[model samples]
Target: MRVFAVAEIKFGELDPVSIELLNLANSIKGDGTAEAVVIGNGISKYAEELAKYADRVWKIEDSSLENYNPELYVDVLSQLFSKEKPDIVLVANSSRGSEFAPALATKLNAPVITDIVGLDTSNGIKATRYIFQGKLLVDILVKDGDTSVFTVRQGVFKEGSEVGGEVVDAGIKPSVTPKREFSQIIEPEVGEVDISQADIIVSVGRGIEDASNIELAEELADALGGVVAGSRPVIDSGWLPKDRQVGISGKTVKPKLYLALGISGAFQHIMGMKDSELIIAVNKDPEAPIFGVAQYGIVGDIFEIVPALVDKLREIKG
Candidate 1:
């Protein structure tokens, strides 16, 4: 198999999902070539870093490609793939990837399997992706000897061992005129805490009852030396800021310890924090879906359990 993985760059640095894409490619490539393709204004450093894992790194740098343009990305990648004719093209299922993968597939006349969470190569290529808002998992099969593009979900694959490779400059330039012009990037306002980076997170959900009741979760988070976050419901209710929301629609997090309080564990919420090292869910309903993914489960009312847990943690601190 000949595989080509696209490396995504954000804020002048390589996106972490780029490494995950490389890892996925390397795992399935076997003895075949696993190449990394990076396109941006100044991505030489990222290309060099990717060379440690990929069989070859193709760096496409140009001043016109400083920011992400869907048309330009599709144009450049379509041209490059036309020359290379890779059997498999791997892309991260990020904001940018979601925009261009389908268009690139159309240009290449290949099948595109998006948001794939699992893959089986023993019997051809069978990819697993969620359907109906993650209510079910469906397997998509690709015929042998066929070219295809796959957008892999983030945090699904582990990082592969680094094997040194060579870096080459891909001199392909985009000929397509972008329909849109590059403008200033409007960054989101920084909140009191970035839950994505928090080591320990205490997250609440609709089960939290009311906005005023959020203090219980806050106190518990404080006692545990963690940051407070919430599910979409709590955020929508104005109890927590958008930055503190954890779900498919919000932020993905992989904290060392994730304590879900009063969370019912919708699939969207599970998708965001399922990669956490340890998950502990506390909800009164034993059948709550959140407990399915949690390492530890407590079927009790948060109003009663949170205060007890906070007191216990404070006693331990003393």
Candidate 2:
């Protein structure tokens, strides 16, 4: 088997999920070859970094790829894969990766799976993904296909150790005329903290009652030496900034400790923080969906429990 993992770049740096994809590819390659494919302009450093983990790195550094264009990406990858004919192609389930995986699959006449959380190749190739809004996991076998493409979910797989490999220059230039033009990248304004990188996050939801109650969560987060985040409801209600939002439509985080205060555990919200190392949910409703995935559950009102928790933490610290 020959596996190829695509690298994703964000703000001129290699996205962390790219490494996760490489790790997954290496794990399943067994006696076969595991390679990485990177497309960008002047991304030699990224390619070099990937070479440490993959058996080989196919670096396609072209001026035309300075900015991401779905059409151009599909065209370039399709041309390459048509000739390479890799047995499996792995892409991150990120915004850009999801956009191009299906197009590339169509070009290669291969089956495409999105948001895959697990894979097994012992018998044939089986991929596991969530169905019914993440309420259930369904395994689908890739039958009757020589090539398969999968967009892997982030934070599902463990990072693997690096094995030195060689970096090969693909030297493919763009030939497709894209209907869309590249524009300047628009980045959201950064707040006092970047929740995605936080070690501990105390998140709020509609159960927070009002904007003023957000201060309670913030105090608890401060006491625990963490940061404050929120679900879409809290962000939409202006209780927190857009950068603090955690959900499917917001930022995905994998903090060491995630304290979901008053979050009802909607599928969208769970998608963002389900990968946390330790999840502790506090809600008055014992049957809230958040408890389904939480490691620790506290069925109580946040308005009353948060103040006590903050006081306890401060006492422990002092």
Name the lDDT of candidate 1.
Answer: 0.87
The C-alpha stretches of model 1 lying farther than 4 A from their native spots are 192-199, 215-227, 236-238, 241-254, 266-268, 271-275, 286-289, 307-318
RMSD of each: 3.0, 3.1
**Candidate 2 clash pair list:** none
* TM-score of each candidate structure, all chains considered together: 0.85, 0.84
lDDT of each: 0.87, 0.88
Indicate the worst ten consecutive residues by lDDT in candidate 2. 188-197
The residue-by-residue lDDT of candidate 1 on 1-318, one tens digit each, is 888999998777787788878888888887788899999887878988999989999987788998999999998888888788898999988888998999999988899999888776666888888777666779989987558999987766654789799999889888978989998987666557657668899999998899899899889988988999999999998999887889776777888899999899988889889999999999999999998999999999999999999999999999
Clashes of 2: 0
| Clashing pairs for predicted structure model 1, backbone only | none
Candidate 2 residue-wise lDDT at 99 = 95
Please report the TM-score between candidate 2 and the true structure.
Answer: 0.84
